[model samples]
Target: MRRSGPAVEQLIGALIPRPLPRPIPTPAPLPNLPPPRAPTGPNRIELDVARLVRAGRCSARTLLHQLDWRPEHRLVVDVADGTILIQRHPGGRVLTDPRGALTLPAAPRQLCGICGGDRIVLAADLTRDRMTVYPMTVVVRLLAEHHARLADGRRGR
Candidate 1:
């Protein structure tokens, strides 16, 4: 007829709403980035290309179409470690099977590399582009958070 221990706490819990956890915050830039370089030739093109990839507002096909370029135009995405090269040649897309054999998919995206909206472009693309993944700032923030978690984990009542 009466509950006054764990059961009582659980009963009260069922009636209360819990707050959702906060998302990770964006980290500030590292102390130094070279003064804005003059945007010209490959430099200008690369800058615009990176901005487009980062914005991710338009489809890759549409993005490529809007640019005044042909199959000859090659674009590279830079990251912390390496680059990703993008070629526009046709019959260039190859699908793979579970057994690691060359295969074909019913429908393959022409620009699957930049398909992800927020996450960094795939690592394979990074190497092909001959660019490096700029992750030191993100790494520092993550490590700081990780160490804070370690301290919290060791705390005792």
Candidate 2:
């Protein structure tokens, strides 16, 4: 071996080859996709959310108008929950006023739809749509009374 100084060592170091760089990782190849299905029959899916929303709004407005509820009265609309809650009483006469249009803080829960004390729940699923409604309990009670009267009359005969 010939004598090598720091300069010769540096030259050898420069001549020496450096190790190759690390290989880049590649993602796995995806599988072949399936062919799209062809429709063989009539397929229709029409969802008129705007129409449904409009219908609900109109129905609520009309009901409030018919019940003579004031515009200033509180009508809370919770779209996320799909519920409408009326906290205040209407000054106008209600057709199905179970405990009158006014609702006291300590009063029992009113079930009449016209009263607006209960929540009006709305639902729309993929295949069905539904809404909650309450009729006057007095009507059922009156019908029962009428049936009882008829039954009594028939028994006497």
Candidate 3:
């Protein structure tokens, strides 16, 4: 014989383990906020694309002008993560020509795997007084990685 009643429910409830009650959620503490201030200098970055010449030179006059980098200004060149970086420094080997041309050194160019006729991305940070050069090869590689990640995410869904 089978039984269906409050007594049966109580017997089953007693036999089965019950889940623990959820804890009451407490609100997180608010962060201390600083007072807002007025804008002072150029807070935006400038970007442009220019072709690398066979002589290891590129023209980014507009970006240079924005950052107040003039002809005869010395620059330090460096390569990091397949990208070239230029910054204003004392006693730097590289210099801005009278015609506003930036001559990159052969070593940095070779290290970054960029050659003549390649389109490069020039990013000028006015506040930081720095310029970053991204070769087309690096750009393509970055794009490919991003696309691969997107495809993986779609597959997961």
Candidate 4:
């Protein structure tokens, strides 16, 4: 009965009710996470990492200082994928001499944790914490050599 324009405008208004837009709430920065913890129980690789860190093969502490590490970052050993992915904070950045660091993130993929495989044997300087991984290949090679040395079964003490 009434004008069509009024009815159409009413219908459109009902469909889309506009409101005064407010600024999007920015996400609060997440807290820093701890570095990858050694898996429960002893692991030969973990032991090796500790040894290397102590020996200064990798500057774990220095790297953490550089990254400003926190508890939020996690270091995980994914045996299934045969990789160690370091999950760092989104905004966090790593500062280092990439050339001096022989990161296993290069060719020959499964290098010594010092050189290959998913477990980055390099020193990760997080804004929260620090961690280290020894080249898996290096570990494998060392293991193989030891096994070979024992090939004769107690041939040499």
Quality of model 1 by C-alpha lDDT: 0.35
RMSD list, candidates in order = 17.5, 21.0, 12.5, 19.6
The top-ranked prediction according to TM-score is 3
Off by over 4 Å in 3: 1-43
Tens digits of lDDT, candidate 2, 1-157? 8666665424576778888898988989999999996533343222121112211221343333334444545432221122222333344221222222222111122223233332332222212222223233544565899999999999998
Q: How good is model 3 by TM-score? A: 0.68
**lDDT tens digits by residue: candidate 3, 1-157:** 8576656323577877899999999999999999896555776678899998999888888998988998889999999999999999988989888787778899999998889888899988888999999998888999999999999999998
Pick the lDDT winner: 3
- Candidate 4, residue 122: CA error in Å? 8.6
lDDT by residue for model 1 over 14-103, one digit each (tens)?
678787899989998789768995644433232222222232322233224333323334333222222233333334453122232111
RMSD of 3: 12.5
Q: Can you tell me which runs of candidate 2 are displaced by over 4 Å?
A: 1-60, 74-106, 110-139
Each model's lDDT: 0.35, 0.35, 0.88, 0.42
Where does model 1 exceed 4 Å of error? Answer: 1-38, 46-58, 61-63, 69-83, 94-117, 121-157
Model 2 earns a TM-score of 0.23
Error of 2 at 12 (Å): 99
Please provide TM-scores, in order, for all candidate models, with all chains considered together.
0.23, 0.23, 0.68, 0.24
TM-score, cand. 1 vs. native: 0.23
Candidate 2's displacement at residue 41, Å, is 57
How does residue 99 of candidate 2 score in lDDT? 25
